[model samples]
Target: MTIIRQRLNELRRRAFAGRTGEIELFRSMLGAGGVLFLHGPGGIGKSALLDVLADVAGTASADPIRIDGRDVPPVPGSLQARSGSGRTVLLLDTYELLAPIDDWVREEFLPALPADAVVVIAARRPPSSRWLADPAWRELVRVVALRNLAPHDGRAYLAG
Candidate 1:
């Protein structure tokens, strides 16, 4: 297996830690979803975690497309042309740069998403709106806040 897959497996072991509930959440999203958001402040492990997730998706034979917010396309329709059929995962890092939720949803976020793939948005915060605040989006959008690793966990992670 590739190093990414190995590292992702390790992350699954450490982060999920026998928690089927959490595993199922990710699994369900991979199978079918509305949207999954991993939001946290800078320097948080958000990017690292996203890397692991993308790795897993690749291992599962999914095509992972990574887009830096700085280079995002200007229009949403362009997304459909870019992402074809199959399991196409669209990941946007540093998504906070795309403000005004409506524009993002229409232009960059929505169109780029393939019908049969998982869409992961790693941002500092969710959109500030009533629709985003709704419980459905809240459930679909898993916000994993960054937390300090315990000394032991840190040491173990490094050793791994």
Candidate 2:
């Protein structure tokens, strides 16, 4: 079953449409030790982009560690352990679920990562004030607003 799912996901990823600019921005920041926060309404393709970004990380010779926020515990230790020290790309999806530990993730967990780690966050809403208010984060964080796909891209994705 897992093998089948992996194959299916690979096919879908190949057919994934649009967001070329977003993908490029993510690629530029890869291994740059910055936060790429992708926010939009539910089902807006943030998770899908992360999937592609994970593959991008692989091609760049970086190991990608993806953790869906819903599956993460509140403990920072657990996340640290799962991510490990070698991960160059850390993808966090469904980030709203991690609200309970948001501050810790921004303040503690992220700060502890290796200098070159790239963290991509997919959430339903824009980042909270804490993330934006911090002066130090201003230079390190890049927020990308995800809008709906264009008509042609939508058609291509659906037809694929």
Candidate 3:
């Protein structure tokens, strides 16, 4: 088990390059409350950054619940029940695929989450205008548009 864990950690370290700032931001936001959206074009490392955020949440003893939009059911029954009373980090990947539930999630589901629950959404585009237009959501939502790795980081990633 220890060896397996070590290998997993090593793999994670390699897979998540040039994402320290984003990971730190996610960690800081977990305690502040609200939603964080990391959006960029395909292959811009959004998924990798989400993976790092999950690991950071685990290390902080927070519950990291990952939802892949492609596989999740539309209604997402009992999702709130799983949140419990602890700090829960909800990571939503491929968010564009869940457009059918977008309104529900933004208007109803997210509002119902526990106070300590923080959501991190990764999509190909920025969040809907509604999130920014509403005074309440505007204050709560933070958007980070990811970009390609710096040349130095790219070199380090390749060398690893």
Clashes of 3: 0
Candidate 2 error regions (>4 Å):
1-6
24-108: candidate 3 lDDT, tens digit per residue: 7777887787899989999898877877788888888887888877776656463444445567689989999887778888888
TM, every model: 0.67, 0.92, 0.89
In the range 18-116, model 2's lDDT, one tens digit per residue, is 999988988888746789999999988998898899888888988899999788786677678887556578999998888888999999898988888
**TM-score, structure 2 vs. true:** 0.92
Pick the winner on lDDT between candidates 1 and 2: 2
State each candidate's clash count: 1, 0, 0
Q: Any runs in candidate 3 off by more than 4 Å, and if so which?
A: 3-6, 76-85
Clash pairs of candidate 2?
none
How displaced is residue 24 in candidate 2, in Å?
0.7
Alpha-carbon deviation at 70 in model 3, angstroms? 1.6
lDDT of each: 0.62, 0.87, 0.81
Clashing pairs in 3: none
- Of 2 and 3, the candidate ahead on lDDT is 2
lDDT, candidate 1, equals: 0.62
Native-to-model Cα distance after best TM-score fit, residue 120 in candidate 2, in Å:
0.1
